[model samples]
Target chain A: MSQRVPVHVEVNGRGYDREVEPRRTLADFLREDLGLKGTHVACEHGFCGNCNVLLDGAAIRSCLMFAVQAGGRSVETVESLAGSDGELDELQLAFTEHHALQCGFCTPAMLLTAKQFLRENPGVTDARRIREAINGVICRCTGYQQIVAAIAAVAQAQQTAHSIRIETAPPVRVAQDTR
Target chain B: MLAGGQSLVQLLKFRRCRPSALVDINGIPGLDAIERRDGELHVGALVRQQALLDDPQVAESWPLLREAAGFVGYPETRRRGTLAGSLAFAAPWAELTAAAVALDAQLDICSAAGQRSLAAREFFRGPGETALGDGELIVAVRFPAPAPGTGAAFHEVSVRHRDYAQVAAAAQVSPDGHGELVLLCVAPTPHRVDVSEALTRDDAIADLLGRLDPLDDVEASASYRQRVAPVLARRALRDAAERAHRRAPA
Candidate 1:
């Protein structure tokens, strides 16, 4: 038996300090140890995106990263994407409204990836770019058109909201300097 | 152990691999750098494919390498897979080997004994095998200063956009503006076809074709890969030449 190593991690807005084997993967830790089953495990390999999670705001394959490796880091799963009041976020709502999921095997990873992709590529409302960004995750149940639609819907809404914010906010005059 | 696991993990799920233990090297610092020193380029072993493609230095300086990195897989796999892992592992059929061979790159390997450097010609021994002995780790790879006015290109045929290459070829034209050719994936290892003598003959293609013994395999027949090898080689040579000419200082 491998020796149990102590690990401190922040998951889904909660801090966890526990002892686990050095060999325990972060995916297994999230699902089995903490009981945050939102992060699915499929294929066990990195090929399937079911084990995808955000490690310090970057999407990565959790199975390939060991739990001990995630020590002293903030790890976010699909569960954190929910609203603070426990309601679905706009992307989750868009997914449901568009019927973007069927078996839901790849939903958590897909949602997490799509969430980060949209935030980074703000105002890139093109359907082709959305497909290219989410191409990292693998989905066999849905044909992927509806998922793309959900992401597009969210991007369009964010753009509109940003425009409104710009229009409503107070503006300050700036002085130009000639050097 | 290589932590990227793009190819190794797939083999594990299929029960084709079962290593006694895996040493995670992803956390190891200073192994993912892309450095340029004294006109030579060095890419660290753990440098990810995505990072390699995104670096402007790599893109502008080594366009052929950039294109090869983009063809590895989708964004996710590229985010973790390393250049040294692919070269050290070789992974049966790989396009990077062909590119490295065409570019005359050097492999910097470090083991308990010491550090040694081997040219790509000597590093790649055969399919799915390399010159690296047990307990040794690939530290970095170095590319020689490209000849002035030389260009290079990499081409492969695959079923899907991201699938492994069925038959990949990389070629570079000489800087002297004379016709010179280097062929990859033409043998068990990436072998260069010596076309110097043949190029001086009337039918250069015919002379080169007569001296080939391409092996048959599951991905592609030896003869078929052999036949298409020169076609892609010719195209790569032309493309690389054009790129070199465009970048050469007047």
Candidate 2:
């Protein structure tokens, strides 16, 4: 038998220590051990993003990685996206507004993916580009057009606000202090 | 594990490959560089397809390569798919291997022994096979710097953008220099055509046609693939030449 290794990891900002088999996948640890059922496992394989989570800030498929490999890593799931007050994020609101989901099985992964994408591309103006970026995600319900629209709306709104600030914000006086 | 798992995991589910153990190489450090040194571009093995699609260096220096990367799988798959694993497998129908072969790229590989380099043409052996020795791993791939006036293009036809390529082709043309054209996914390895002689002729396409012998498969007939190869090759050549012309001094 291979030796069991001890791993310490932080999930949703909470740390935990566990001794586990070297072969155990991170997805199993997340769902079976931690009981964070929000991270679904549709394809145990990597095609479906249902098992996706943010690993050290980048989106990765948890099912394809081993628990030992993720040792000492910071992981975030869909469950961590909400505020303590249980308020839905702008992306969640947009998803609901556009009816981007039907079965809801793929929603958690979709939302998490879009969240990461939006952060990297803070202010994109083109809807076509957004649609193309999200094209790999499969929605059996064929509700993708709306999802793209919702994300684009949020991005456009952010861009417009940024441009307004650039145009209207006042400049500092010559006596501006640098301390 | 299995690096990207974009195509591998799907194959596992379909019973195509069932390894008892899958080593995850994504977490491996220093496997995602896209640096240019001297006169070659070195792309780290684990670099994601999505990263290639949006890389400024790739976009400006090799637009056709970027466009080819964009056409692979889909957004989610691209986010996880690694260039090394895709080529290492070299399945009969992989578009990446075809593109690499067409571009005359060099593969940098690592194994228990040490590091070795193989030209793309020699790396691919047969369907689902490669020249990779056991315990060896691909570290990166290198592409030669584009000449003063060079252009390249990659194109493929599939049931969908994300589907396995039914027919794929890539071409590179150098002004007043040698040209390389290849067809992908039509056989075990990407088929390269030595167009040095035909390229000098006025009707290069007609001459190039005489040298090609396409394979027959269910997705597309061998005859059709053979016929389509020339058309795609011609288009790729024309596009490359035009691009080169635009970059030339007035």
Candidate 3:
């Protein structure tokens, strides 16, 4: 006898409802059941981060979580990075510009991992700190120099944009407005 | 329940652990809280490792736990892995296991019958084992916050910074040189050794490493652990004591 567990998850701005076995992993559910192949599974163990995804905006190893655990939560896969108009996000654009991928097997996880890193750390510019942020997402292709450069480029641009926004904004003359 | 699938899901995928059902404990409330109450730091079963690392109090008050979380796994894995799950698994080299043992943490458990508690030192029976019985679920892990003049540090030797440590050591130093030294990945469990008196004779401490009977495995040679456990222990002791001295102002 077997039991089926029901899960309602929002994946990449889309909601999905399914009844999966309690044993099916989030990686398997993402790739097999939902057919979102962007989440690649390698080394099925937690050692390799090929199956990394974002659970509630935090990077998590998809292979290490069951789908039932993801119930009522929002899951963002590598597929979520690109927009519906087929445009790349800032980090994706930087990845392409820096030649971050060679074989591209680890690209999906690299993208999601770097995305979450940049999100959690908004103004991080130190090279060592950037390296530590993405240390878990291993890429045998580009030797990590390009990957580090890609994520750093986005963070740098974000910092620049943030400072510019503060400097260029119009000053408010009415300091106190009580409604 | 899905305490943290970092290790459990992998075991399921490889057909290593075939449990009849999973409880999916994420739906439960209050199991993910990390708070201080009754003079103890309570870490719920679902409290992820990142939460502990991010807490300012845990960082300043119990920095050894934060240090151990950094070495547990990759950044993504840490986002989902939980402390109680790691302690329940009781991997010999697990960072939090050594931290729990060194801190003398207490584990709170619950079942259909009600609730109970166990000491960290008494929890782990062997590799991949704990004292938790059937129907009993680890509700939270309570750590006695290090007292005034207390300092602690965790150190490990691994091929890569993120790999499972070959040998791990954690030391909590208090005033008057009474400290607790625990070593991991060297024996069948997180081995806690009272270093209160041992600190008086620093030169003879190397002989104490022989009690662990370090294991041989693919990660490293048995000789490597034997050689490194004491070295790491000495390093931890020095740092821990130095930190303790910092806490006790002149």
Please give, for residues B1-250, the per-residue lDDT of candidate 3 as tens digits.
5677787776777888888876767769999889888888999999998888899878878877887787888778877888988888777888999899888899999999999999998999998988999889999999998876787778888898778889988987886788889998778888787676667777656877665678789898888898898899988888888888988767
Give the backbone clash total of model 3.
0
Candidate 2, residues B90-202, lDDT tens digits: the string is 86667677778877789998887789999988998888789988788889988776665667677777766566766676766666656777777555578887777655664
Model 1 misplaced regions, further than 4 Å: A175-179, B8-21, B147-152, B172-186, B193-231, B241-250
TM-score of 1: 0.86
DockQ of each: 0.45, 0.39, 0.77
Candidate with top TM-score is 3
User: What is the Cα-based TM-score of model 2?
Assistant: 0.85
| Per-residue lDDT of model 1, residues B99-162, tens digit only | 6776678988888899999988788777778999998988888877566555666777765555
- Candidate order by decreasing TM-score: 3, 1, 2
On DockQ, who's better, 2 or 3? Answer: 3
> How far off is model 1, as Cα RMSD?
3.5
> Model 1: clashing residue pairs?
B151-B240, B152-B240, B215-B222, B216-B222
Candidate 1 positional error at B197, Å? 9.6
* lDDT agreement of model 2 with the native: 0.76
CAPRI verdict (incorrect, acceptable, medium, high) for model 1: acceptable
